[model samples]
Each structure stands twice: as structure tokens, then as C-alpha cells.
Target: MKVLKFLSVLVVFAIIGFSYWIYSSLNAPHAHSKTNQYIQIPQGSSTGQILVKLAAEGILSSPLPLKVYLKITGSGNEMQAGEYLFDSPITPLEVLGELNNGRLRTVKLTIPEGFTRFDIAKRIAKQFPQNPPEGENAVLNLMEDISLIKDIAPEAKNLEGYMYPNTYDFQRTVTTRAILEKMVGEFKKIWKPEYADRALQLKMTPHKIITIASLIETESRLDEERAIVASVIYNRLSKGMPLGIDQTAVYIAKMENRWDGIIHKSDLESNSPYNTRKIVGLPPGPISSISESSIKAALYPATTNYIYYVLNVEKNDKSHRFYSTAAEFERGKAAYQAWLKKERR
Candidate 1:
């Protein structure tokens, strides 16, 4: 009787100890060096393989206890595969939940309203570099593949104004091609049917409207004044006068890969068709990315007789003063010149 009682008590204590071990091991949090980065789990990996891999990666201090716990619970069979970003001090149970849900790690890529393809290339290169370290020029070459937007703007030389400006979330392992496709896809989505109809009424192609929109985007940061700026552009074009937009000279400098952050006299004198100072009407193509508001302003310019605009020094908000006559324009130009001189000092 005594031996039987001792044996029963020992068995009970052993079970209790085993239960505690399982609970503690499954619930205790563990962190690793790769907590900040993405860990890719290739497709068709077995649960056991995943545990072992996690153990190797320090995400699991030891997989034995979790394996036993899963076996006891008949779990771990529903684990899915994908790129995962595990948080620091995450418990094994939490990691398992993440795997079961297949929650992917995403990174945000934001394209500002007026970023050029070159600027985008630099951002992409910095954020999502290729395994072999792709250069900015290599990324720029990808934008040159205009086949993506051939249906929308068949005459487009490259994807300058078609990449919609917005914040996009992509998987950490997303390719540059995928990012470019998404941006262009977004642009296509926002190019409303009404815009096309309006373009027809204006006797302008979608490409031309986007080109004008790009100019407006670079010329004015104020959405309210973009239409007025667009009117100045249209007014100049109607009178067969040069656009004289300094941003076009800057764009020319960028195209030539000699942009020194300042528009020089040589840039203004450049004979490139993109130089608005030298060529009449719109540039050969867009000089920068376009925004929806700019596109709208381009399609529906405010009715005005304005032909010239200079920076409004009084407003101090980067707004421009519009003028209908050369005399009025010259006075505004003088104020802008004085402001520029003061700024330089």
C-alpha cells in the first residue's frame, strides 16, 4: 500500500512539472538580432522545418518545448509561409499566430508630388537596393520602359508624369519593377474618363495635359493658384510666346545631368526642346511627376487674360503675382528681383 501511494504521488508531480515546462517555454518571450528585418519563409516548408529554422535564427531559444506543446495540442499544421517581421521579445505563441495568419512585412515608399524619375530612382536605390547594389542610373533605365503606359500616352517617351504621387506600401522583397508598375497603375486608376472628355474639349491630348500639369506642379506649390499659373501658360502659348518657365531650364539641366541646384544663363539658353525659354508651346514631354490637382488645373484653367507671373514677395507664401501687360509684369518682376537679391544677401 505504501509503495503504491509513493508511486502515484511521483507520477502526479512529474505530470505537473511537465505541464509547467510546456507553459513556460511556450509563453516566454524571446528576441533576436533579425527582429527588425524581414525573414522569408519559402513556400512548402514543413512546421518542423520552420521551428528548426526559427531556432537557428534565434527567434526560438529552443524548439523542443514548442514542438512538444504543438504535438500535445495537435497544432502547427496550419502555419502559412511568407515574409514575416517578428517583433522583439515575442513569445513563441505570438510567432505561431503570426505564421498562421501569414502577416507579411511591408515597407512604405512615398513619392512626393513633383519628384522626377531621377529623384525616384535615388529614393528606390536607397530604400530597396538590389542584392548586387543597383545604381541610380540602372533604376532610371527601368522608368524608360514606356510600354507600361503606351496605351494611355502612346507618344510618351518615358514615365515622367504618369507615376502617381502617393504613399505606397510594398513587401520588403518587392522588386523595383513591381513598385513602378504599382505607381503607374495608380496613375491609370485616377485618370478619370471625364478628364479624357475634358481633354478633348480643350483640343489637347492626355499627354499634353499631363505635360502641362507637370509644369504647373513644379511652378506652383499652392493648389489654389495652380489654375492661374495654368492660365498664364495657356495665354503664352495662345499668343505664340515662349513659356519662359525657369523650371523647364532646371529640368533641362537635370536631363543633361548637370543640375547644380541653380538655373544658370546657359541652362536658359539651352536649345533643348524641353527648355520652355527657347521653345514655344509645351515641352517635348513632362518635366516632372504630376499631381491630380495640377492635372485638374491643366484641364480646367481659370478664365483670365494673364500672360506673365512673378513670385509675390509681399505674400511670402511662394505665391505668384499675375500680370496681363508687360508693364505690369515688369513691375512684378522688379519686386521679385528685389526679393531675390535680399534673399541672396
Candidate 2:
């Protein structure tokens, strides 16, 4: 009977000791001094890898105890992959909790309005460096997956302008293709049912509407000006006149992979359907990402007789001076050229 009592007491003491050890380890501060620097945890990393990483970073004095605790709590398989930051020394339990909850480190990526897919590809390439990081061209090639919008844009050569412009929180683990998919998904959500009906009224397909929206987006930054710009495009199209948007020249230059910042005379002279200055109607596809305002402008254009517009140089706000006659447009063009020369000098 005495032996049995002693054994029970011994077991109780052992349990108390184990509990104290765990509590101490969990509440103890780590050795990390670099508060600003984040620890990048790659995807598919195991608990063993995590522990080793923590020990190497001086985040843990002993990895064995944490590993044991994680296994005991069934959290060994729950460590999420992401960039993690420990602002101050934290307990192993806290770190484990963070990992289990999956507070992934993310970067705020804003794809600004009027950005082309080429521009987006550059930004994606810069953000994500794979084992060796993909180049700009590689990223561009990934964007060639046009199946995302096939039903909407049956004639889309590639995902040139369908990647919607918006701010995104991208996880480090997210692939370049994943980002492109998300952007296009965002575009799909914004495309309302009424937009199709409106397109029907305008005798335009959804793809053509997107094409017009891209033109409006590239033509001017002003929300108020988008409708007027859309009207000018419509009026020109009705009259069998060239769209004359210089941004289309930039798009063609990018397509031919010869864009060098300056719009070369050869670029303007190129006879591609994308070169709207030479093409008599809408481009074969969108030139840049379309925003909601630009889309709305394309669908609900204001009625106007104005067939020409030039930058309002005196205002310098990217505002335009609209004209219905060729002579009026010529006067604006000369003034714009003079201002351009003065600025260049």
C-alpha cells in the first residue's frame, strides 16, 4: 500500500515538473534583435525546417522543446508558409500560434489605372524572384493564358488589357500566374449584366467595349473627360475616321517588342491594326487595363459633335480642348506643339 502511494506522488510530481518546463519555455523571450527584418518562410516547409530556421535566426534557444510541443498539440503540420515578422522576442507557443493562424506577410501592390499588361508584367517580375526569379519576358509569357476571358472575349489574342487595375495584397507565396488570374477575376466581377445590354445598344460587343474603355483610360486621366473622349472615339468611328490615339502606337511598339520610350516615326508608320492612328477603327484589342470609370464612359457616352481634342496646355492638368471643326483643332495642335517645344527646351 505504501509503495502504491509513493508511486502516485511521484507521478504527480513528474506531471508538475513537465508542466513547469513547458510554461517556462513558452513564456521565455527569444534572441532576435532585428525587429524590422522579416523571416521568410517558404511554402511547403515542414515543422522540422521551421524549428531549424528559428534556431538559426536565434529565435529559439532550443528547437527540440518547441518541436515536441508542436507535435503534442498537433500543430507540427500547421505552420503556414509566409514572410513572418517578430517585432520583439516572443514565446514558442506564441510563434506556433501565429504560424497556425497563418498571419502571412504580404506586400501592398497597386497596379495603377491605365497600366498595360506589359507594365503589370514588369511589376510582377520585380516583386517575385523565383529560385532565380522570372524575367520580364517570362512574366509576359505567363500572361499569355487567355482562357480566363475566352467566353467574354472570344477574339482576344491574349490578355493584353483584361488584367484589371487595382490595389492588391500579394502574399510572398503567390505565383505570378496567380496574381494575373486574380486581376482578371477582379475584372470579371466588375463587369455587370447591364454593361452587356448597354453594349448591345451601342452595337458593340463586350470585347469592343473593353477596347473602347482602354482607349478612354489611356487618352485621359480625368473622370469628367472620359465621356467626352469616348464620344470623340464614337464620332470618329461613325465618320470612318482614324481613332488617332497615340497610345495605340505605344501598344504596337510593345507588341513588336521595340518600344524605346520615344514614339519613333516608324512606330506611327506601322500598319498594324493596333496602331489606331493608322487603323480606321477600334484596335484589335484593349491597349491598357480598363477602370470602372473608363468602362462606364465607353458604355454610356455623352452625345457630342466634337470630333477632336488637344491637351489644355495652359491648364497643365491634362485637360483637353474639344473642337468640332478641323480648323479649330489645328489651332489647338499648333499651340500644343509650341508648348511642347518650350517644355523640351
Candidate 3:
């Protein structure tokens, strides 16, 4: 009996020691030289394989502790595959948690509001260039495939205004097509059933609404000014007056691959249908990507007789002065031109 009791006491002490070691291994922070290194675990890698790979990469001090913990906790199958960035002085348990949660590293791409397709293509090419190093034109060609938005906008020539402008995270190996698809998908999500009904009420197609939204987006950054700008656009359209937005001229220059950052006199005189100075209605399609606020403004414009607007130089805030008559518009235009000349000097 005495021998048996001694043996039981030894076993108890052994268990306590083993538990303490496991606890220390799992919970103790380990400092590694490889900080901020992105480690990718390919698809279908087993839990054991992941642990070994992480151990080799110094993310794990030793794989045995995590392996034992997983076995004990029956969590060995919870490990997921993805690109991971492990910080220095990380605990094994924390590493396991990250792997289990699939917190994959991603590349952040931001498409600002009012970014034209040309701007988008250039940005994408710079950030996520293809293996053979395709230029912006090649990326732009990818956008020409309009099949992604066929149902929502059958008349759309390309995915210009359809690519929702927002910051998005994608895998490092993300294809340009996949990125474009994701953006168009986000746009579809915001294009609600009620919006379609509203379009019907206004006797405008989705394409037309997006075009108006794009114009409004480029014209104003203020939420208050968007509806007012929409009113100006609508009022002008009703009176058969030319939209005369200079951004359209800029868009024309861009399409011809000659946007020189300065709108030349020749640009304003261009016969391109996109030149709102020459065209009576909305552009053939959206010149830039639309934002939600701009879309809302287009759907519900403020009731006003204002048919013209010029930059409000008095406020110095990027706001505009609206006018109902040619005389009022000319006076506002003169003030704006004066301000522009002063700023240039």
C-alpha cells in the first residue's frame, strides 16, 4: 500500500510538471528575427505541415507544444491556409489563433470617387502589374469586357461607372479581372431594387442615372452641393441648354490619350459627344465612377430653376454659385474667372 501511494504521488507530480511545460510553451512569448515577414501557407496544407513550416520560419519556438495542445483540445483540423504576417514576440497560441481565423495578408487598393476608367487602369497597372509587365492600355482593355454588368446595364459600352469607387483589399496574386469583378460586384450590391423603381419613375435608365451621378461626383465634393448640381444638370437638360461642363472636355482629352493636365482650347472645341460643352444631354456613358451620394442626388434632385453654376470664389470652399438666368451666370462666371486668374498668379 505504501509503495502504491508513493507511485501515485510521483505520477501526480509528473502530470503537473508536464502540464506546466505545455502551458509555458503555448503561452510564453517568443522573440524572432523575422518580424513583418509574410508567410504563405498553400491550400490543402495539413495542420501538422503548417506547424512545421511555421516552426522552420521561427513563427513557432517549437511545434511540439502546439501539436500537443491541438491534440488535447481536438483543434488540429481548424488550421486554415492563407498568407500570414507574424510579428516578433508572438505566442504559439496567438499564432494558432491567427491561422485558425484565416487572417490573410492583403494588398489595399483605393479607387477614389470621380476616378475615370483611365485613372483606374493606370492605378491598377502601377500597383498590381502583370508578370509580363502589361501597360495601362492592357489593363484598360480588360475593362472593355462589359459582360460582367450586362444585366444591370445592357447599354453600357464598358465597365466605367459600374466599378464602385472604394478601398478594397485583395490577395497579392489577385488578377486584374478579379479585382474589376469585385468592384462591379460591389456596385451591384448598392444598386437596389428601389433605385431601379426610382429610375423608372424618372424615366431614366440605370446607365443614364450612373452617368448623371458620375458628372455630379466630378463637379462637387459637398453633400449639400450634389443635389443642387443635379438640379442644374436637370434644369439645363429640360431647357435644351448645353451642359458645358469642362470635365467632359477633360474626359474627351483622356479618351484621345492626350490629357495634358491642362484643358487646351482645342479640347473645349472637340466634337466628341462626351464634350458636354458641345453635347446637349448626358455623355454617351459615364465618364467617371459614381459614388452613392452622387447616385442619390441624381435620383432625387432638389427642385430649383437654376440652370447654371460657377465656382463660388467668395467662399473659397470648392462650392459653386447657381444662377437661373444668363446674366446671373455671366456675372458668376466673371467672378470665378477672376479668382482663377488670381490663384494662378
The candidate maximizing lDDT is: 3
lDDT of 3 at 288: 94
Clashing pairs in 2: 130-133
Positional deviation of residue 147's Cα in model 1 after best superposition, in angstroms: 2.2
C-alpha TM-scores of all predictions: 0.92, 0.85, 0.83
Better of 1 and 3 by TM-score: 1
lDDT (Cα, tens digit) per residue for candidate 3, span 169-278: 98778888889999999999999989988998999998899999999999999998899999999998998989988999999999999998999999999999898888
Best by TM-score: 1
| Candidate 1 segments whose C-alpha is farther than 4 A from its true place | 1-12, 30-38, 131-133
Q: Candidate 3 regions off by >4 Å?
A: 1-27, 62-75, 130-135
Residue pairs that clash (backbone atoms under 3 angstroms), model 3: none
Model 1 TM-score (2 dp): 0.92
The better-scoring model by TM-score among 2 and 3 is 2
Deviation in Å, model 2, residue 84 alpha carbon: 2.2
How far is 21's C-alpha from truth in model 3 (Å)? 6.1
Q: Which structure is stronger by lDDT: 1 or 2? A: 1
lDDT of each: 0.90, 0.87, 0.91
